[model samples]
Target: AQSVTQPDIHITVSEGASLELRCNYSYGATPYLFWYVQSPGQGLQLLLKYFSGDTLVQSIKGFEAEFKRSQSSFNLRKPSVHWSDAAEYFCAVGGDGNNRLAFGKGNQVVVIP
Candidate 1:
């Protein structure tokens, strides 16, 4: 069985502050991991992914994450989050194919100015 769980359902942070979102997964083998962001009433955008190489992976919008095999976790982090960074974040895992993706419910991020 393969599945993903994000403990936090929502998070609020002040602009220009560090941010970290947690993600946990349950899978039999090494799995393809991904982090996606979606703004209110918008589609998902890929933040980053961990397939096989180095544990740390960087994304487009100044975001990065580390894949911890032992913890069965792939948590996302940003040094200084921007107001534009406020959005819903989802952690996903896929293997068999790209056809389907199992997504965590999502963690809504609110940025206070």
Candidate 2:
């Protein structure tokens, strides 16, 4: 079975400061990792994903993630976080051929001025 773990449950970052969220997975084969962000009353929005090819992947809103197979980690980062970036971020792992995914508990980000 595949599972995702986000060590940090809550994170505080100052506006315009860099932010990074850690995600670690447990799976037998190569896994598909994803980062999703959800605002206060909004649904989960895809931030970035890693399937294959490149180790570093970028997505909308200046968010990027790197897939480190050697460490079984896929961490998400933003060079400069905005106030709008405050949300709950989730890390998910899929690609088991069953189209199922295991998600982490999530990290709640609080952006302060």
Indicate which candidate wins on TM-score.
Answer: 2
Q: Tens digits of per-residue lDDT for model 2 on 12-63? A: 9999999999999999998999999899989998889898999999986899
Which 10-residue window in model 1 sums to the lowest lDDT? 94-103
Candidate 1: pairs in clash:
none
The TM-score values for the models, in the order shown, are 0.94, 0.97
What's model 1's overall lDDT? Answer: 0.91
Would you give me the overall lDDT of model 2? 0.94
Which predicted model would earn the best lDDT? 2
Q: What lDDT is reached at residue 96 by model 1?
A: 59
Model 1 earns a TM-score of 0.94
lDDT by residue for model 1 over 34-59, one digit each (tens)? 99999988899888999999999998
